[model samples]
Target: MGALDYVLAGVAAVFLGPEMFSLFGLPVSLALAMVVLGFLTGILVGATPGLGGPMAMAISLPILISLFGYSADALLPVMGFLIGVMKGATVGGAVPAILFNTPGTADAFMTTLDGYPMTQRGQARKALKVAHVSSAAGDTFSDIVLIVCAPFLAIMIERFLDLPEKTALLLLSLSFIATVVGGSAGKGLIATGLGLLAAFVGTGEDFYPRLSFGTEALSQGFGPAAVFLGVLIVGELFRGIEDLWREKARSGQVTQYDLSGDQSLGWADLRRLAPHIGRSALIGTAIGALPGIGSSLAATLGYTVAKARHKPGAGDPKMGEGAPEGVAATEAANSAVSGANLIPVLSLGIPGNVAAVFLILAAESIGGFTPGPSVFRFTETAVNPELVIAFGLFTMMMLANLMNWTVGGVFMRSLGFLVRVPRQLLLPVVLLLTLTSIYVETPRFEVILFTLGFGVLGYLMRRVGMSPLPFVIAYILGGRLEETARQAFAATGADPFFLFNRPVALALMVLALLVIVWSVRPKGEAS
Candidate 1:
């Protein structure tokens, strides 16, 4: 089939909403089932503190590998599950915040400002419904934007960028991501440097076993899957377990809130919140497109803007005092990040957030689907399989959105009783899952040890308030960055410093330096 034919076929499949169709011996129904399963699991996890989308993706990626093996067929179901988790987690986070005044995730902290107050006023159902609506709308909006833009962006890069420009752009991305994310710019860079160093070890031509330190086991570098899961999931599990153990004795029973009275939101309320949802969705899409800047900032900025612009009706209260629009603004903003986070991942192979990192990991591990400009290289002779898979992911995302829209309200409202599962109970299961998942991928005990070591490092990074986002990102991009730089260098065998003569590469270098300088500059210092 032609490339255009494949594109059109993928689009038709999406709109047709095929349930029983199978491709490459894999059924779309299975993918849909995974979407449902992952969404529910995400809701469960996200409603529980210390569990989020990364944990879900980390645990599931290897299991998916074990189930499906390394094949192109694995993409749809794996991506479906991951997308479901991302959306579900973002929406589910609002439940605990409103019901217990404890945010289910970091991004939902701001949601507590209004959500908890609404619960106190016996509007728990109202608050949850608002969260559901806005979250669905925001996610759908961001996803549509991603589907429209990512392929075009990739094609543009493929058309315009030479090796030197691509290499310089990657370097610029690394610098930008490092500085923009995490608690401290310096710490972010340090983490990124650690990742680059780790990734460079044992896997290059110059040194077949670079930094292997004479160990036979180190002859083969660590898999990106192990490193990512170990640092993000295993380490996080350990911390959560420690916290759970310490608090288990002090924490008796979770205080249950009464779900009584005035829970119904009128059509007028929806009308009032629609504009805020749309606006917050746009804000979040923009923020999420940028690497490293997370949903927490998006939610905060969304709520702040809504507050500044809010002129509530006579009966309606101001934000932070239980305004339903507050719920819409915060939830819409955070949830929108789920879909838009994939924008960078699809176009540049740079994951914008924790969930996207694993999506890249899954694609890489499954093989044949490398995300970058090359993925979107369209020609009359050959079909771009990745492009079609991108559409499949889009279809999965839409399925998840549909699920969220149809059942999200009921699920959130019912979660009051369902979320009684304690961290103490869940932590052990997650630990087991982590070990089993990693062992499935690599049967070696040493790999487990290496993973644990990375886990420990990740724990320490978290302890020091350093974000691991930059670390994982750099690790994932390190090989590609190196490859591109070498290609650029070889292309300019005449002069080692050839980027100086390349206008695009030079412009990117200048921009990167400016960004670093601006990032390092004192906030109070005059320019």
Candidate 2:
């Protein structure tokens, strides 16, 4: 469809879709309001140290559900808000990494390697601006990919995939995610298996409680939002607090950035980063389309590849030493993965990451739409053209990107002001906001207790050098794995060899076993 056509369609969807908004006894446009609210919310969540995009989505889902009540009008705006947060968070993570040597998200860890050093060298503002621009460019390009490619892929998957083949495809996707993410094959398999186990902890569809430990609350499948926020957001809060205590003991001076210098990107910088941006974007998009893989993996792989291709002394001044290219490569790849991750969800009904899975849930709760190939079919009848939603989402992303680029530098500069504020003031604010958001979601004081408990668990896990990604992934995928296993068995009448009989399924099973073996092998051994 033409650009103008897409725009008009999106405008119509925003106005006509199902959402309840009333102002002064007149009907208000909820989709437009959601778009605006989502952007602001994203900025708030992204600017916070512990809260990331996935946690934001988890917290927002139920609120949107209660407010909008499962209308297409309601769903699109919420999705738009999520997209804003995802994009904003991707850039926002760099702020803490640059100023305090603390990575706000896993994807921003690489930023710390260079960013913190630059801060020590008194170039914090420049580094922060570079990060913002590069991240925005990468994210904007990825959204473009989502606009162009997702629909075509959806059509193809709808035409070809059978149940057994689809199952095999999922296995392949998971294995690939594990291998690419684990640092080594063995680590990856271990992480993936661990994640699967964590996912199995609460309850299954057969009304059977698997690992509830006899607790009534535990019997009702573990809330994904709780685990996600606990492990990521609350866990980081504890870490930040501990760091505060150390800084207090040492009487460390809080370093602040001077933003008086120009923060705008020049054409020369863009030209230098162009190739790396392209390469990382391609890598991220491909990785994101696969289930189980995520932006972290894409960022790491992109950085590694960029480092390997560097010419002698091309990294002179050091590659990990405040080089904008490093930030560009990592940010571009990770941001691109955000868009690509949606591909599998929108097209094939499979989630590519924890965030996408939550998005699927949100879509279901708000739109009464099951996320899969069939969504496109239903869009043609039950709602406006499917393409309209896609276009609207892309437009929202573009708006979010513009906001990130223009306001991100200002936001980072303002954070420098926070350095002057005492930790006593900052910590309480952070704690209060977190508690309030969590409480609003569940209304249970026990949830706060659980969050604190998980925070300790998360901190301990980090200290041991064990990757939490595996656990999180397993926790997210556990229910689906169990359901699929049950379905496969039912189809085979409990025949153990049924999986082996299907060529595609057998191939996937073999691949999964091989991945385990290969990952377990010595580091020097070839897969």
Best by TM-score: 1
Off by over 4 Å in 1: 1-4, 11-28, 245-249, 524-527
RMSD of each: 3.0, 4.7
* Native-to-model Cα distance after best TM-score fit, residue 413 in candidate 1, in Å: 2.5
Most accurate candidate by lDDT: 1
lDDT of 2 by residue, 1-527 (tens): 55466667776666655546777876656665676566556655555665667767766776676666665566677787677667767777777777887676778888777677767666777777777776777777777787677777776766765555566656665676677554665565666676676567666665668788878766765555566667655666677788776777676466555444354568976887788878888888888877666777788888887777655345344558766677777877887888778877777666777677667666645655555666454342244455577656666667676676677557645554333445556655655666666777667777777767666766766656545555665665556656766776777788667567888678877887786676666766432
- lDDT digits (tens) for residues 287-316 of candidate 1: 999988989999999999999989978887
Model 1 lDDT, residue 298, Cα: 94
lDDT of 2 at 419: 33
What does the lDDT read for residue 233 in candidate 1? 82
Model 2 residue 121 lDDT score: 63
